[model samples]
Structure formats: structure tokens, C-alpha cells
Target: MMDSNDTPVDVRLSLRVNGQMRQLDVPPNVVLLDALRDRLGLTGTKKGCDHGQCGACTVLVNGEAINSCLALAVVHDGDDITTVEGLAGEADLSPLQAAFLEHDAYQCGYCTPGQLMSATELLSNRKVGTTDAEVAEAMSGNICRCGAYKNILSAIQETRQQHAGAAID
Candidate 1:
């Protein structure tokens, strides 16, 4: 049936967000970032550059880091999506979050959520090395307008070292 006055068809997506399964009927054109924020009320994932040029909307899709703004909600059916809210424990902060606070990795705090999510993936993937330059290059997609690159790098490195040390114990 073709009609000029018809609205776009809404597709049902079953997404596991922050360890909870959620069902949503969203339009095919709805971006993952909008779905997470507008529909699920997970506002921790910031919307910086909607075009994916900025990494403010970064989130973990099945443990891989991706820009939420660039992904369509309909395409992520049955996928695991982790926002910044998922990074912390029920009573305490994750190691990375704690490191960010200890290292003062943020200035304005607007980009911190995306920065944390991206850092979590980077640390877990073993793609980033134990160097400041490597961390910077790996995190290049995230843009912190306050220019807290040094502190962010420190937090990532420290968290990595902590995990490495824990592995030995």
C-alpha cells in the first residue's frame, strides 16, 4: 500500500541496554543515539556532533566501541548496547571511572561519558599500547573541547596498569 499521508513504518527492536533487555518500536530512520536517549532516557550518552565527526555519542555495541549517532536503531536488534551508565557498579565506580576522577580527566564534563566508554573499549580490546601517544591516537575520535587530552591519557594508562597488576596478583 503506497500512500502520501502514511507515516514511516516502525520496526520492533529488542536491545539489551546496560544489562537489561528492552523492547522498543522505532522508525527505521531513528539513530541509535536518539533511541538510547529519547526512548530509553539514557542521557549519559551525549550528543555532540550528530554526524559522527565527534565521539560524544560513543557507546559499546557488543563490547566494541562505536559512535551511536552513526548506527540505526533498527539495525541493532538483539544487540548489547552499553552506555556510560553501565560502566559503574551498583555501589562503586569502575576502575576506569575512578581513574578519570583521580586524574582529573575532564574539565567541562560534557564529553566525559563518551570518553569513558571509548576508553573502556580501548583498554579491554588490547589494541591500545602502554604509551601516551598510542592512547591519544586510539582515542583521537573523541574530541574534548576543554583540551583535557593529557589527563584523559593518564587515566586510561593508569587503569590499564591497574588491570595488568591485578592480573599478576
Candidate 2:
């Protein structure tokens, strides 16, 4: 079984993402965001500040949010990753996306992806309820310079109402 001709020059890393497992040969220096956006063509994860200050590069790793910009592509092999594009199928949008739109939660929308990621996680956690203050505190990690906090909080609160049977998300 030893064939010198088949010896690969680089190792292929496997990535399990959005319920699919894929592999890629990436250099050690490449960041996860670039690998996902550039190589893999998963462009939902945006690049904002790039220094971890702006949470625009947020993605979910096994249901927990992580800054894609700071993660190394070569290191997270076999990990389950969820980007903004992974949230829904085809034309349908996730409830958070609909909620954000209904409340006009974004201005330029540069920070919308990260905001949605944080909001999605916070909303799912029973500990973080629908109160304006709670929503505000939970979303503090993702900065929206557009000052859309009020609307964002309203949207979260409104989404919560849907869960409680108001039937308007």
C-alpha cells in the first residue's frame, strides 16, 4: 500500500459544517474567516474590524459563538461550524432575521450578521429573557455603531411575544 506517488504534500483537514462534512488543504497562516469566505465561498461571515473588536466575523461553533477572524482554519478540523448562510435554506429566513427586518434592526447592515448571531444565541438561552434591559445587556458584545439598539431590543421583545402566543413575529 505504500506508494510514493500518492504521498500528499499537505494534509487535508475535514470540516463539518451546516450538517455537511467537507475537507480543505489550508496553510497554517490562513485565518478561518478567509478560508471560509475566500476558499470555500461561504461569504455570510463578514469581515468588519478584523481585530476582534467588531463582532462582524461571528460564527457558531457547536452552538457557541466564536469570532471567525481570530480562529485558525487549520486548527478547527472536524468541528461543526455555523455561519450566517447556514442559518436557513434557499429563500426562507430564520426567525431572527425576520424579526430584525420587522423591527428595522439595522441601518447600513454592516454589523447585522454578527448582531444576528449574538441575538440568536441569546434568545435561545432561557436565562436571557425578553426584557429590554436583558436584551440590551445580552447584545452588548456585538457593537452596532448605527445605534440600532432600541430597535434591536424591540425586535427581540417582539420575537419573544411570538413565543408567548401573540402570533406576530
Report lDDT (CA) for all predictions.
Answer: 0.92, 0.81
By lDDT, who's the top model here? Answer: 1
Best by TM-score: 1
The Cα error of candidate 2 at residue 65, in Å, is: 0.8
Q: Ten consecutive residues with minimal summed lDDT in candidate 2?
A: 1-10
Predicted structure 2, TM vs. truth? 0.83
**Minimal lDDT window, size 10, model 1:** 1-10
Off by over 4 Å in 1: 1-4
Residue 14 lDDT (model 1)? 100
Q: What is the lDDT of residue 157 in candidate 2?
A: 78
Clashing pairs in 1: none
